[model samples]
Target: MTEKLWVFDTTLRDGEQVPGCQLDTREKIIVAQALEALGVDVLEAGFPVSSPGDFKSVQEISKAVSNPTICALSRAVEKDIEVAADSLRFAKKGRIHTGIGVSGYHIQHKLRSTPEAVLERAVKAVTFAKNLVDEVEFYAEDAGRADKDYLAKIIEAVIKAGAKVVNIPDTTGYCLPVQYGALIRFLKENVSNIDQAIIATHCHNDLGLATANTLSGVENGARQVEVTMNGIGERAGNTSLEEVVMAIKCHSEIPVHTDIVTKKIYETSRIISKLMNMPIQPNKAIVGKNAFAHSSGIHQDGVLKFRENYEIIDPKDVGVEESSIVLTARSGRAALKHHLNLLGFPVEGEKLNEIYERFLELADTKRDIGRKELLSLIGEQMDHSLLVEIQDISYQGAEGKEANAEVTLEMGDKVLTGSSKGNGPVDAVIKSIKQLIEHKVILDEFLIQAMTKGSDDVCKVHMRIMHEGKPYYGFASETDIVLASARAFVDALNKLPIKATN
Candidate 1:
């Protein structure tokens, strides 16, 4: 039988602690609702006593989300616990999470207190919070580095004092996976009342072993995993919720199951990243941009033959429409054929072999191959109705007046014109083009590269446009950078599905 693994998300608490990632009350509520929809069992809204804004955010989040158990963070102090409880007044289900330092280092240096005094305070805090809320959780801060016997004693005392859950955090991310698992096992064996309360794992990622340590804890006996979306937190960040959930899902022998809606993982990650102003690294696991993308020839060939050959989780499982076969210098004949077919130009045998040679030559210059490059490589005539050609462009800029741009575009025999004002010539030109195209697109990324070290040097533009959650790549080069940018945008626009033009 698979035991229920509680997923406690501390994104709004721990994750928001990342400088400049803080959210207002309204934004907090929006995230709270999204987390609830994602099926997190516990939502750590905020440390209510930290500020008036945090308190209001927590209070509003409690009202906004009802499915998950709304949780608030606090120290073991009376005032913090009181404020935490008050902030959850509107929650259908509420938990007060309070804790203190427990390691010898924390007690001696951080807390400036003795172990005995800390133990007494831990019990008192739980007893205090239990009276205010039906669910009370106590954290033994820095438990990963605390003395095993003393840690067991405090955990038992808190559980006896009415803490329904005990959080064991790898505060400095100092413990190895084996050591962390042993720590959880030690408590399971040494603490007499351990069975009365659940043990939760809250590992950090300083050594990049947070996910490994968390899995070790779950395997050893810990039933709950506290994490943050996209692993956003202080310093190195916290355990990734998507990573842990998907790991357990992939390996069913873990004997634990979370309520996380696995398919919604990718979209939720993007929302948190955009709202928090943190960009997901291209290679981060589970929800990163390249998670479902295959570029190498061998890998692309294997994936094209059968998805499971290289991918463990189906792209659709995480809400991605499909896997990406990114064509590059390392890409194989199979990968080239895949993209060619996608662009409506299928080739085989000698024809495919001939294109493969030219592809490798072009791929060496371009990182990613797109529709324009494919058409040019195969010597196919331009599909006028589908291709967008920049006819003319002009922009005016002054010290005080906003920059304005006018652009003329020709597609097949049809000509379209647009004009707009923006902060700069490039911005105005892109805005003007947006008015000419019917596709609702966001320029996700725009990069410019100089071909040489002089003002007369030609520049290359790379643009990534996102339409309906899918990305399209484009590239162009010209002496005029603004014109190159416009051409790049048009190149990417040509790749959008024809329905976008409707």
Candidate 2:
């Protein structure tokens, strides 16, 4: 039988510890509500004693979200536990997380206390917290490097002292998968009261083994996993929520499951990336830009034939609309035909062979082939009468005044003009263009890259729009950024599956 695994998210606590990624109280409340909607079992809001701002954020988040058990972080000190308990007074279900160093080095150097004294402090803290809150969790800081016998001894004491959960944190990320798994197993075997409390794993990514160690802990007996969105935290990072959730999903033998709404993972990742001002790495697993993009000739052919052949997880499962078959020099004829069919062009036999030869010649010169380049190959055989044409675009911007723009477009026999004002020239132009379209479109992403250095450098604009929950992409290159932005917007707009022209 599959067991229920609790997902404890520390994005607002440990994740916000990253430099320059701090969130205000309002932002913390927003993320807390989102985490509740994502079905997290526990949410570590913040350390209440750190600052007044953090205390307010934790208190406010407790009032905003109701599903997840709101948790507050603290040290073994009585004052810290009291403040943490106070912050969660508004929470429907609150947990006090208190801990002390367990490793030899931590007890000797960091805490400058003896092991017996540290154990006493740990039990005392948990006992005090249990009296203040219904649920109390005790963390053994640096348990990965701590002596297994001592770790088990302290954990048993905490559980006896009323801790409902015990956290085994690889604080320095110093343990390998085999070693960490053995550590959890040893505690289960040696600790007399271990069965009374849940075992939680909190692994760091210092050596890039956070996810590996976390999974190993689960394999042994951890019932809860502490994680952050995008693996973001102090130092290297923390275990990624997406990675852990997807890993258990892909492997059934693990015999555990989570309550995550997998389809909302991508959008949640985007929101965190945008709000934190941290860009998701292009190759990041699950939520990266190239996660579902295929460029190799063989890979593209395999994915086009059967998605399962090349992908274990469907893109739609993580909120992505579909996979992307990028056209590059390494692409094969199968990929070429796929794009050709998408553009409403059919070719076979001698005609296809003739076009393939020309495509190869051009592909060798260009790194990526886009729609314009493909159309150039089609030449007179393709119809351009119904294409959307940019007739005129004008915008004005100054220091303090709002930017204003006007746009005119020609589609077959129809001409439409629109005007608007915005925070910037590009925003104004996009707003004006939206007025001319009948369908509701939300600009999801916009990126600009400069190919050359200098005043006349050529810049490429890439835009993505969401219409009816599906994504449509556009691209344009020009020296004038405003003009390029308008062209790219129109390019995506033309691809919208709408029948009306006016």
Candidate 3:
């Protein structure tokens, strides 16, 4: 029988510690539901004693989530435990994870106490927590650097005090995999009554060894692993849940099993990234943009012939839609032909050469060329009809405390100029353009974001306009916000006639 490993997700508790990664109560609940669906055994909701907002988020998560054991982090203090219990009132299965520093550095410098006092506090905290909830976890903070003998004593005391699980965390991400594995093995061999409680490993990735350390702990006898999604946490980060889970499944020698639904990994990562407004690195593992992208010539040919020759894991297994054969400057004839055929354009011989030349020219100018651009190029080659609706003219903003804007419109042989004053300059420019075009389209949403970082940065504006109850989206970028907004508005207006009527 395969040994089952318990997955303890600390995205809510520890992952939220990263600066600027704050999530509101609703967003926390959304992520908690996703984690529950992903089959995490324990969800560390939050540290209730941290702040009122954290307490409320923990309370809400405990109430909203039912599948996983909702856990609240607390110090060994009585008041912290009370707050944790209150936050977990509605949870079907509640856990109190309480711990203190046991290392000599923390004892002498941080805690200013001796090993005996630290062990006493650890035992008392666990005993007190056990009385309130059936599940009580005790963490040996900085256990990686702690004296092996003293660490074993503390673990033994916590077990004696009724800790159902004991966690050995490399809090500072300071331990190598070999040393971390040795620590777990030492605890197993030296700590009396160690078998009574589950040994959990929580590793940090300061040296990029968190996942390796976690697997090493499992190999040495730890049955539970603490991790976070996207490897998000303070400083370096915690062990990535996706990386560890996938590693365990792929390594036959490990033979560890988890209840996680692997297919939901990409969606969950994307949802978190969007909610946090953190852009996923294109080269990030598993769920990144380039995870399933093939770029090399020999690799692409091998992948095209036999996918397994290049890919060890199928993209679909991780919820990725499919592998993409992107055409770039480094692309070959086969890739170019494949992309063209997929775009519903078939060309051969001299025509193919002409199209490929045009594609290379466009690709050189643009960072990325999409299917629509290829189709437009093909349409131009075929002499297809192109509609021209809006024509451009110059415009300027009025100078005053409450300034308006002036606009000019040239469509076909008609020339019209108008001026309007409303809420702001951009609004006035839009109103003046609308009057010239004579189109009454309802503006649904308008957003402006900086395209680059600087004092005088370019801005990109996205606009959604509704015409006849159908929505059309368009975007524009420029150094000036007013121009970007006007161009975005005009772009949306241009799509109106092409939009199919409902």
Best by TM-score: 1
Clashes of each: 0, 0, 0
Q: Relative to the unseen true structure, what is the C-alpha lDDT of residue 129 in candidate 3, on a scale of 0 to 100?
A: 87
Best-to-worst TM-score order = 1, 2, 3
Instruction: Kindly provide the TM-score of model 1 when superposed on the true structure, using C-alpha atoms.
Output: 0.88
Per-residue lDDT of 366-466 in model 3, one digit per residue for the tens? 64444446666665332112222334434454432344777766655666687877565777778878787656786655667897999889999877666
Q: Is candidate 2 or candidate 3 better by lDDT?
A: 2
lDDT of 1 by residue, 260-286 (tens): 998888878877886786878878898
Residue-level lDDT of model 2, residues 291-386, one tens digit each, is 888888899999999999999999998889898787778888888888878776767778777888899899999755755567678663323434
Question: CA lDDT of each candidate?
Answer: 0.90, 0.89, 0.82
With a 3 Å backbone cut-off (N, CA, C), the pairs that clash in candidate 3 are none
Give model 2's TM-score versus the native structure: 0.88
Question: What are the models' TM-scores?
Answer: 0.88, 0.88, 0.79
The parts of candidate 1 lying over 4 Å away from their true place are: 389-434, 440-470, 474-491, 497-502
How close to the true structure is residue 253 of candidate 2, measured as C-alpha lDDT?
93
